[model samples]
Target: MAEKKYKKIVLAYSGGLDTSVLIPWLKETYGCEVIAVSGDVGQGTELDGLEEKALKTGASKLYIEDLKKEFVEEYIIPTVKAGAAYENYLLGTSFARPLIAKRIVEIAKKEGADAICHGCTGKGNDQVRFELAIKAFAPQMDVIAPWRFWELNSREKEIAYAEAHNIPLKITKETNYSKDKNLWHLSHEGLDLEDPANEAPVNKPGFLELGVSPEQAPDQPAYVTIHFEKGVPTSVNGEAMDCETVIQTLNKLGGENGCGLLDVVENRLVGMKSRGVYETPGGTILYKAHEKLEEITLDKETQHYKQQLALKFAELVYNGQWYTPLRKAMSAFVDSTQETVTGDVKLKLYKGNIIPASVTSPYSLYSSEMATFDEDDCYEQGDSAGFISLFGLPIKVRAMNDEALAEKTGTHFPSVE
Candidate 1:
């Protein structure tokens, strides 16, 4: 056993296999008091019996803070409004880690802990996310990452340690898949999914918790109308609701119709690529609806620039830099662009599809009079002659220079082989 390093340590616990074992391991290795902190970010039944389990496993105390509202209003909605989709990932787990870790820091400071410990493996992105948030909030606190230097290197070994400690864990090799759940999404990784060659078991009955496969979805399509107020979704089907209720309603509606299922082999912030499947039922609907609303609301240049900024925003969030200045600045800019983004978007949710049905906004940029093909007083067809000439000037100039060079060298510059 290692010598004592901290007298009291706050753990970002999830009641999972890794954290379940870390409780006893920390006490035995350092003779420290473990205060487990679990942030309730709409994980539903996953929090069952967490208090009993934490105390039974050697934790001095456990704090379960409800962060669902903050998570949706602050983290999830901003990303959704900004359209930050990273290579098809909705960034469910990526953003949740920082929020959970930030709460752990708050609890740590409240309890006057000497250090913070986590169950994140050295190979994954959560370690980076947790530590960065901790550093941002409490730079002086130490982070004890056991996976970086521990004897229990593998999941099998950790199970053995749990068994030796007489701890109860309802996990088996066949069903052991690393998962993260919150209001926004549910992610499944590890197990057979680690092998990219193997297809995701999307159709399996018990594989997906938040949603279903396209084949299992009902044949009839469902339609949902989302209302946005300055880029944030405010209502569903014309029924006004809070942010949390709005997401909950959409998750059920979208899930039943097989709307939001994604399997991606994405690049991780740890300098490696990993495969994972996600069920983002509500988030998927909101993204599509918000995108459709933006189309009719934002000007072409602002919309185009926001799209580019979204990629960088996604990277910052994925890389665990949520507390950074650049992220805040970008969000401010996105909020500015959303000033006129109030609208209603109707969508048809079929099997694995979110098709735009209709969109309307008070500040719509689309002008039917100016864009009509038939005779219209708002626009003149003859103006295109001058517009085309100015637009193609660079191309015309380049071609003229090429022709002159061809004539001088007695060669065919426009020759095609």
Candidate 2:
């Protein structure tokens, strides 16, 4: 292979197996100074000893930036408010990648790096997300995807390469699950989850990180009230907490109640189906609460339309189109709809069940007098005759045409009956 004359490269490092190996590989391959950047999006203690590890491996400098508050307030909150879930999978990993890539690009520019590198495999969705985010921010910078260029095809191969180069790693042959975690969620893939026929080891003790299984949850149900102000969760169980603390508190409560566990076989951006288990305890609660609040506050048309927009929003987030114009436009619409979505939602969590107990909002469009069965001054029962006739006119005309055709042809034609 011919040598490239790149001076410096910025890597979106996680201090994980793939990134740990990438530090040395990039230096050896391109002879560039590697600057490792690890964004802290509520991965908790996972950032510990990361700087030393990156430097010890091969990186010239390591940047562990605190991105938790920004991630929650900017990315996670808007996504939750937009109700963006990709095929019922909470976009925990999807949304975090763009932010991480954006930060890496920032660091790359600051260091005057020639290229940016990421640990995302060629076959996975993160590659697309990271690349798209990078392109959005810095289109001229070269992207070095080592997974595409390197001969390390599998975990075993990568481990072999690491061992041969005297590079230390945490992964071993016994490690089955490939996991990604942040403040919003923890995702598990590979291993037993790779097979569609295999059931998730939810019954196992250590299978879950954010929460416990429904069976392992307490027998009694847990009730909690969530308050929302303009679609953002302000308080949980009447306690006002910051973005970080609120999510953490709800993660504990929702996990104990067996909430926010999902098993999905989703179509990946790479055109393959992948199965994974996601634990999003706090996110689940917020989703349910936001939905309930919207139910009462938003009018029928806006509420229904926003529900449709949410699917697209989910797709954009999942595909890493976070910085695109369409996402921004959709978020504007979502924010407009959320202006009146201030309210409280009461829910009962039991054995992984999120049961809506009650929902109340001062801006609620629901009127008791309008929908009552009893005689009321607000609504007249006799008005329904004209309203029904006007509403059913298209169907009535079609049925009439069918009847005339049947009579004329001396054959039975399908009617609206």
Candidate 3:
């Protein structure tokens, strides 16, 4: 396929090995000016010296915007409310892509760029997520996926190309595991993780930043209280804070207690299974607190229905359908249910266990008068007998009919003609 023509393009640059090389490659392939846009969603030290690095490698300009607050408030909170966890794994990296792609499109329009470029590999789910989000947000802007078009197939080849052109690289071949980090979670893949049989090097200091090993957790348990308003966490331990601060505080505390660490072989949307180790200390705590709060506030039938919707919601988010109508409808339903989800939950965090201490909600359907075992004016012990008989009518009728048939035919009713 012939390369699309463009005078300028906006590239989602991460200042990493793949994106660092992508900057120059876009320029050489399309002969277009590459404007690099890097969104800061709490990548911590990775954003250091990124602007200088981008300009040093032929970028016309660089936009490094702090999107941490927006990421948590807009994307992460909504996913939490929807209870969209894919295969028991939080959709951390999955949801971040759309927000990053939206910013890329905005920059592309502002710069009058004809196209947008990304460094996501062809085999990964991110390539689909990024391009699909770009398409959803900016249908007219052309998308350039370098990995799909480039002849170089391996990271070794990319490193060689970078060296041939004297491109500055931060990653070496020895420690080339692909990592994606955000405030919500950090994911590690490639290297030893690529082999399913290889056990994770849990003792490596570099591998265990988010939390201490479960063995190292303090013997004394830590307690935390989270307050929720309309299903979104509003305060921690009675102190009100912004969305970003709440997540940051929880991350710190949960990490200290060894709260969130998961290793799973998950099925990728692209039809391949991959193993990943994720650390989501804060998210783990928040999920448990939110779930326990809902138990008190929501009715049994509504809660059961929402559990069914949660699975579909997880699938839609994981498959990168954030902008679709079905997702919008699901969000609307989730929001409606959350109106009564105001509550507070107390939890005990000990050795990676988050145990619910207690939960209270103003909208709680639990009536002490109706639910208490002690006798009271609202006592209804006799009503249960009639209720049970009515509820079991179908089963009783079936059994009687089967008995009559068995007596008439002298055979077991279910086994005979």
Candidate 4:
């Protein structure tokens, strides 16, 4: 069958090695006018000079949309409120992919492009993430994945192609590690990090981008107080700031202390186990503080049940199911649990550790009077006797039946008194 020709293709441009080469490749291979769209999700300095570069690489134009504010409010807050962490990962790149893809579709529709393209490889989770999002909004739009199709299989080949085409490369052959960075976190994969046995070269240059290593962290502990309003962070250290500002503040504090380094071999949705190192400095502080706040505010049953919901929520986000109905339903359930999640949590950051100094909440369910051993009117000691007896009634009945049967049969049945 003949392939449908694409007249105009919208490419998710990152200005990185793959996408840098993609602008020319898409044009040369498909004979299509390439429109590059880069979503600005707080990837500092990565966006710089993207316009000139895109134009230089055969793209008709570039769209550097500022999606940072929307990214935090729309994606980051709900995930944090839901307490979703995929296998100890903070779901940074997971949730951001959908938002960026959605924006690309919007631009595609506006530009009247025949198709959309991404630089994600066939083996990674981002391919599913980008395409699933595109399918949700613009299912009919033709999608192009150059890495899965192009002859340039490795970074070495892509670098050679760029040089042949007079296209500049940001990274050299010696230090080419696939990385994804946003406001929420910075992730490092490939190189020696691909092997689970090898430890992350945190002390080495280019290994740690966002923060200091634990050994290089400061000797003195830094204290921070974060205020929350209905599961949303409102302030840091008594100063009221916007959510973006709040995150930036915590990122600075947490980065300095080496608080959020995660080195793990996680299950990728592509049916493979991949190793990566993530630095989610500010996000780590917020997640810890938010979870601690819920400890005081949420009831025992609600908290326990919410924890189960959180695990599923993380799975949905990690598996690129963010735009689906199940995720919406789970988010709704998470929001209901967060009504009373209003509080302030003080934490002590000491060299990769987040120690809770104190936690306070207006809606806290913790009762000092009931929990006190000295004297308490809220809880009756006599009631515990009745509660224990009732709770043990089923066990007592089973034991008596066993004992009766044993005696009649001349069999010894030992029971704890």
Candidate 5:
């Protein structure tokens, strides 16, 4: 069959090994012009020289977008407010993918591209995220997933293909971890992490980027005061900051105090289990503080039900169902519950421990006057008898019925003694 042809394709390029090789591969394989697009979701210096590199590697052009603020405000904040954590692993990578992919789709539409491309593997959740976003926004655009169709299967093969094609590469076959970094978190998969039983070598010099290991952290704890308004973090250490500044500040403080490191073997959306390690120093602090604030502000029933909603939200995000109606509905519910969650939570961060020092909110349901051991006139001491009797009526009736049955049958009931 004749090779498939595309006039123009917008590639979600990271200037990484796969994407670098993809530029020329797409040009050659599909006979199309490739425009590489990279989202700056706060990978820091890793994005440097990406444009020149992409152009040098045969991309017609490169669009490097700064999405840090939008990512935090629109994506990270909602996930945080919902307290969405997939099996104790914060949805850092999961949360960022949809935004990045959405950007890619927008660029594709603006560039009049026939298709959008991504470096996501078939087995990973990112492919679902990228394609779903594309389908959501631009249903007419085709998706070119190279890993799905390409002959190169291993890092070794990719390196050889890159060398043969003279593609510039900073990634090598021996690259230890398959990582995805954004303002929200840094995730490490592959390498030693592929084995569930193998302990992550956190002691290794280059293993961690966002924070230190708990053992290497300082013995002295660090105290931070976080202020939230309607469930969104507004300040850290009593100083008001924008979303970027707040996250950056907290990342530094929490990293120093050994916060936000997680390792887990998770069930992938593709019906496989994968092991990964994540560093989310700032996110951990924000989540802990927000949770504390909710404790003081939210009523018991709302808190309990919201906890259940949070689990579903986490699953939706992790499964790449961000644009779905169910997630939006859940977010609405989460937002409504956050109205009274405005407050300040003081936390003691010590060696990976996020201990709540104090929580205060104007809407706090806790009443010291009513809860105190030293009695006040408002307390009705005699009300307990009726409450207990009514509450235990079922048990009392069951016991009496059992006794009556035993007497009628002339047989001893087990509990009669």
Candidate 6:
């Protein structure tokens, strides 16, 4: 083909098989110096020896940036406030892509590179997410997607290429499931998961590292309280901590309790359905607690309206529109609604269930005097007759018309009994 335009490329490297292969392929194809950049979003042991791995795989230099605090405070918290769960998913993988892309763009600029590269496959949603994020942050930079360009199609071919080139990779042919892990979640896909008919074992060993199996969970229930200030989580139980600490603590606690493990067959943005098993223990607990706090703090109208905005917000995040004006506007609305969302939520975690026990907000709209069935000075029982009549007017009208028609036709309408 034609010669590549760029002389230096910054790759969003994960030290995975695809990315490791891409480093060599990019150098061979374009003869460009590859600078690998990996964002440390609390991937834990995955980040170990990544610099040595990247440099050995033909990278000229490696930059591993720590972005855990920023990721949770900036991206994850905003999503939680907006209640952005894409088709019931907590947008675990979806939210991390933009932050990863942003870091890649930053490294490209710093290294004076003209192009950015990634290992996202052509058929996957991540390609769109990564590319769109690049377009948003640095529209002028050339994006090199190796999976879209390279002739090597399957994982087998890529692994064979890696073997031929003597590229040291952690993944082997026997266990080839593609995974992405961070502070928010761990996602598993590919290999045997491609088949819908395949039954996922209830207790698959080695497959689940983040959470306890339901059968292995503690018999006694565990309880914890989460404190939020303006919709952002501030503490666990009664301890005040920073953003990163809160996530780390919750992740450990929720994992031990088996609080969050989801297996879903979801439709991708690329018009294909894929199955993934996700472990999002911390995120699951946070969402449940946050929602419970909102139930007491927000008024009926505002709460319902925010729920509608949540669907749109989730779509934007899932579709990689994080830097868009619409997302910012929606965030403003979400923030405004969250002003009174400061509260404490007590929860009961038993096995895999996160049950909300009690919630108390400083701005709570709930009033015992107004809501109680007992005799109260704030409410008069006699007033319910007029209110109920007006509330059921449409239903009463339809029913009366149907009754009149039935009487005129000398036929009895269907009765509830």
Clashing pairs in 6: none
Task: Please write out the lDDT profile of model 6 over residues 1-417, one tens digit for every residue.
Answer: 426666899999888889989888888888889999999988989989988888887999999999888898889999999988987889988989999899889888888998998899999989888988899889998888878767888999999999999988778898898999998998889888778688654377888778886677899988989999999999998999887788778888898888888888988998989898888888999889999999999889999999999999999998888889999999999999999999899999899999989999879999999999888999888999999999999888878987998989988776433
Candidates in order: C-alpha RMSD to true structure: 1.4, 1.4, 2.0, 1.9, 2.1, 2.4
- Report the C-alpha lDDT of model 2 over 163-207, residue by residue, as the tens digit: 887777666766747899998899999887999899899888788
lDDT of 2 at 198: 95
| Model 6 clash tally, residue pairs | 0
Off by over 4 Å in 4: 408-417
Per-residue lDDT value at 313 in model 4:
91
Question: What CA RMSD would candidate 5 show?
Answer: 2.1
Which candidate leads the pack in lDDT? 1
Candidate 5 per-residue lDDT over residues 195-271, each given as its tens digit: 88899988789788888999999999999999999998888878888978989999998888789999888889899
TM-score of each: 0.98, 0.97, 0.95, 0.97, 0.95, 0.94
lDDT value, residue 270 of candidate 1:
81
Estimate, for each residue in 184-266, the C-alpha lDDT of model 1 and write its tens digit.
89999999999999999998879999888888889999999999999988899999999899999999998898889999999
Best by TM-score: 1
Better of 1 and 2 by lDDT: 1
Model 1 weakest 10-residue run by lDDT: 408-417
CA lDDT, every model vs. true structure: 0.92, 0.89, 0.88, 0.92, 0.88, 0.88
RMSD of 4: 1.9
**100: Cα error in model 4, Å:** 0.7
